[model samples]
Target: MIHRLQNISELIEVSSRMGSDINLIQATGGNTSIKIDGYMIVKASGKHLANAFSENIFVETNPQDYYYNKNGDIKIINPKKSSIREGDLKPSIECNFHALLPKKIILHSHPIEIMAHTMLNSFHSKADLALKGMNWKYINYAKPGEALAMEIAKSMKVDNNIYILANHGLIVCADTVKEAERLQSNVINKLKLNRRVLKDCELESLENIVESIPDAYLPNNKIIHTLGSDEWSLELARKSAYSPDHAVFCGIYPLIIKDINQDWKRLMQGHTYAIIEGKGVILFENSGKYLEDMLLAQAEVFARIPVEESVTTLSINQCKDLVNWEAEKYRKKMLEKLVK
Candidate 1:
């Protein structure tokens, strides 16, 4: 059994570095973990990786105490006994999956390059070709928590160290934290695709809309313009969100606005941002920096999707499942805290 105290320093260092890389993680979207003895120390729910070292965001728990139902619901054998730490901070909802894996260190991230491929309708075929040399495992869509963990458990093998969650993210594991990071880097290098150059468009129209909108409607009461002026971004905004990150953070799809006079709240439903024609994207008053990163990631993912292949987006039911998840709500709350 490894001593948690002995490894805390390295764990903190690795977590912070991984979290700070916007190319690999956005907001509190990804999770990291270290296992010693029967306990798993994981990034607490709602904790950002960039701050994983500075803050007390790790939770110690006995992952064996959790079980899953046929329907994917999680059942903790005993909450009080399961925890090895004192505080309200909760371990990542993915704690069970981390526990089930055989590796000593694990890192999960939502890299845009990886997402760009996973979002494709031909994910199985395309990924098969892209990740030719690696022993990678893929999970069909499973709601986070028991269902997702259960899916991973089924396919995880002793030899395979990389996993791709459909429309979700990537996972890399190794005996050491640095090795895990290396493996993650290698996976990204292998799957990386060239970004598309956006066609030019005029943004003078967006300036007018920004001036007309009340400060109350903008995030931080500041009007932030993004993506809409680029021709590629405009077409992407019109399409449906195909991945879990896009659906959960950006919404089922971006709200396209042609007129500033429309009821902002009514049209936005519960989405975080909107796309205006000939203008650009507009964020809501409550939108946080974490959200802004997600929006940018969406732009990158959309730009990276190859022009020849058509991508399939998540369906309405799939989108509903993600947006309504309680765990995701907590992450959103943490993101909101960051902007304040």
Candidate 2:
């Protein structure tokens, strides 16, 4: 019993620390899990990894077929209770893969550096070279759910642990929390690329336009303005989404206001954010922190892919796949119910 408590405590510590790193996590965008006494304790759908302590953000799922630990493995007869708002918690949509994986500790994260490489047209070769010595594999982008889980299963080898989910994120697995964390750090350091340094925009310049539109406002996070600081990053931001969170949080494509002074309201119709071409980004008053974090993640990802590099953004169909998913709908509903 003491040993089980120790494992759960360690899992919470690692999940909280990883959840707090902006470069690794944003909002409730990532998920973490650990196999304990034959059961999978995974981050609940729409729950913040940072709230592992304050809230019951975990859901315990039993693998119908796969036994977590094979030899004299702990079977924890009565698993820990899993509930939220007097209802049974839902495991992450990505839980299928977690159940299939052999590792005890698993973290599905979206590190900026990994996304940078994913943006490149030739990401497979780059990942191959960067992660040569490590047991790693790069899988093409698949909608998060059973589809993605099946794809990973098709490519995963017995020794493979690091999964570079193209146009998605990274997943590292290990026997213990410490090893999983150490491996995650090593993958980031290995896959890190040189970013295109962007020039800064004078944020004060936007003060003149705030009063023009009733809904328009300058963003609180200064980093979001980087969206318009460079031609490539601005173009990337102007184009389609770089990843799922980008599409789900910020709209598939931000409204591009050629001139912030003109009647830009028509263009912003349903958009959450907008780029004033080369000037900077503007946001609606209700654009929450989750939206801001996703936009900032784009700024970070775009700057890392050199201006000359070829990139691929999600297609309209692909974007629809994510935003329309029932899982995402539930997440949005969950967000609305959380106390601000």
Candidate 3:
């Protein structure tokens, strides 16, 4: 048992180091865990990785012995302390999934480039293609917590070391923390290399239209002006474009509008801007600007990467798949809002 805890301590150090190195996780956006004996030392909920060195990572009840409630939430019972019960130091909202993974070391994160791809419905096949021959599984999207964990446990095959959480992030597991980190780094590097080419563009034509929109949305209008000319728009319309995932969330095709009024009308009709075409994306009150900001922020992250680094490009068919998925999600969200 003493040796096991020592091993777990080493695993935690490796996990924390990798999390810091990857740029995917900032503050507390990701978590890591190591299984020791019957217990697991998971990154404590809401703790930043930079501060997640040796002492502060919390020690909770053994995950193996945790019980499920009627609602499917795990009821963690800490045997060591009389006061420490199920609800103390709320387990990670994703704790159950981490608990169920068969690997001794587990790491999960929402890397901007990866998240941009995963959030789009079109990229599933692309990811499958990229990861072909690798030991992995892709799980459909599910709400976080016990339900997700249950699904992962059931869907994951014993031979797979990685699980791509649809619309979420990636999970890599291995016998050792170093192996898992290597796998993650390799995947990220491959994705970067695959997306290096810039889709052809000619931005001289949309100068007038770009002038009218609010400045808040046009952080880099000079680039937009250079890339979104009428001729550029027409040409881009004929060809598929590149973006890590904007094509998936907003749609594969740019909604070319000659005027702000037309742009408003299209948005009112429910359309999003494509990254390649520089058509501004629209957000509805029901869907909220938060989700829109997330998408744009993801795009900005990709934009910062050098053009030579992004090798993969989304196909036209993949773009259509994302449009259909986002449309369905929007419909469901609108329906729920109406109900409320």
- Whose lDDT is higher: candidate 1's or candidate 3's? 1
Superposed Cα deviation of residue 14, candidate 3 (Å): 2.6
Taken over the whole model, the C-alpha lDDT of each candidate is 0.73, 0.78, 0.53
Cα displacement (Å) at residue 335, model 3: 32
Candidate 2, residues 1-340: lDDT per residue as tens digits? Answer: 2354356888889888988888999878888888887777778888888888887777777753322333534221212232212255677778777877889999899999998888889888887887888998888888876677767877877699999898889999999889999999999999889876786777667667666777888876776787886777787786778898888888787777676666556655667667877678888766765777787788888879887788988888999899887888888777767736
Q: What's each prediction's TM-score?
A: 0.86, 0.89, 0.54
Instruction: Indicate the residue-level lDDT of 198 in model 1.
Output: 63
Instruction: Name the lDDT of candidate 3.
Output: 0.53
State which candidate has the highest TM-score.
2
Residue-level error in angstroms, candidate 2, position 115: 0.7
lDDT of 1: 0.73
Worst 10 residues of 3 by lDDT: 221-230
Q: Write the per-residue lDDT of candidate 3 for residues 163-191, one digit (tens) a residue.
A: 87764567898888789889887776655
